[model samples]
Target: MAKAFASQGDMADKKISFTEVGRDLWAFTAEGDPNTGVIIGDDSVMIVDAQATPRLANMVVEKVRSVTDKPIKHVVLTHYHAVRVLGASAYAASEIIMSDKARAMVVERGQEDWDSEFERFPRLFQGHESIPGLTWPTQTFAGRMTVYLGTRRVDLMHLGRAHTAGDIVAHVPDANVMFTGDIVEYHSACYCGDGHFGDWGGTLNAIKAFDVDAIAPGRGDALVGKALVGEAIENTRDFVDSTYRPAKRIAARGGSLKETWDAVRADCDPKFASYAIYEHCLPFNVARAYDEARGIDTPRIWTAERDKAMWNALQA
Candidate 1:
């Protein structure tokens, strides 16, 4: 039987976990679903990534209220993916920030992404009707910016391109913890649909240089301790390398997309099959890897129609 298209079959709700990786630093994770980071400062709170919709984001809000009554002052978008940014309205944060490159992507392909993702995975967008519209960042920075939440210092930097060309990491210096959006993941597949395979490793290295004590990764459990942090970073690197190498090799030989797909599965399946969204991400990852190898530097925009076409062609 043919596999389901994208995450269409993944409708069951995932159990959510809110873990504390540092003093007042929290990670809201949902069984390998997209994770959100919460950083509580002296006076207010800073949210790392917003959930898919207002209803979904309210769950995070509820979690926050349970701990403290501090108003959420800032919403920092790690990148411009629909699942990560559409719920910005829920926070009512005074400042919604994104990297300059990320904002450009929002202008270029945000709507197409919203349409594509909503079609690809229904579960994430359970409260789609509540979404106000395309989330626009109130503020943007070029390379790095530091925000002081009272006395606490949180540094947001675009280390390099990994998951997407405009990905950023939020580092809390006092806690020695980092909220690495999707630049790093633990026990979950890195969605490389709009990724830069060549620059991903270097970005990982840039993150490693921080030697953070803990990390709230994009889609996995909150990582605490230096040992676990290093392990997750390396594992993410390996996952990226494993996916790209076989696909690149196949593409170099002028192989078909299906041929590249088979090669990627042969290499990645044994290792990543049990990962969350591994199957959902494989086709897109393989397609992007193949394209990059064939000299397509920019990832093609994925629309609702394009998503179905790609899934059908690959699953055929």
Candidate 2:
């Protein structure tokens, strides 16, 4: 059992732990590790967000088997991040699904993201060889889709952009649970370089309208109670506002990216300083916030070299 978030310190042996959230819903979590949600219907199961590699994803398979033998008939991608989408084949899912926009993101920047993320976090991609190729959805939906396991309904909705343009959430109305891709992370510094800050707050509100009894955030522990659900969304909103304010202040004053980072760190570090992957996320978050503040409507492509250049310019 690896202590959670040891990846934050480059500890190589950290393992993940998955928690059961409801009767047939399990929230797969690790210490600050990316999360995967398991939704069991009457006869089949669906996995939300595949892990970084097949080897890592198999660990979730083991955890799922501990509870049920039902085959995972579907794999629902919350977004297109390599860590979340690459190891999708490990599941028994015959039908892999994602939003229409998610499919386009893969078309647009999948390869670049794959390289960039590998450089940013090597520990997550332990079994890199197992990834066959860029994951493609067997089925894609535009606005919303309803999946059924007998009578159980899984409502997959694109509730506006937040973590990424293609970000979506799965709401089990009966269970009143939602799996928010990277849109809702608990006690973790959100990796928001690919995010839309202005719209994220609206997206959170959209999720809350579902009146979820519990939440399996993209990272961190499952929200056990309704009150905790509110807290998680609030914290996520705060992180965006905090990052944006400083970045905007710097942009407005015509300051350089380095100065923007410095301004943002004074507030973010003191508060989210100890969050999971806090250091790893700072440079990227600052870049997105800075660009958005300067009227950059679209997110800039983030290559590995660009990631390093930004980190050096801001952190060093």
The best candidate in terms of lDDT:
1
**Which parts of model 1 have CA positions greater than 4 angstroms off?**
none
The number of clashing residue pairs in each candidate reads 0, 2
Deviating ranges (above 4 Å) for candidate 2: 1-9
Model 1 global lDDT (CA atoms, 0 to 1): 0.94
For all predicted structures, in order, the TM-scores are 0.99, 0.96
Error of 2 at 69 (Å): 0.6
lDDT of 1 at 75: 97
Clash pairs, candidate 1, are none
What lDDT does the true structure give each of the candidates? Answer: 0.94, 0.88
Cα lDDT tens digits, model 1, 1-316, are 8888889999998999999999999999998889999999999999999988989899999999999999899999999999999999997746999999999999999999999999888999997999989999999999999999999999999999999999999999999999999999999999999999999999999999999999999999999999999999999999999999998898888999999999989989899999999988988898899999999999999999988888888864
Q: Pick the candidate with the highest TM-score.
A: 1
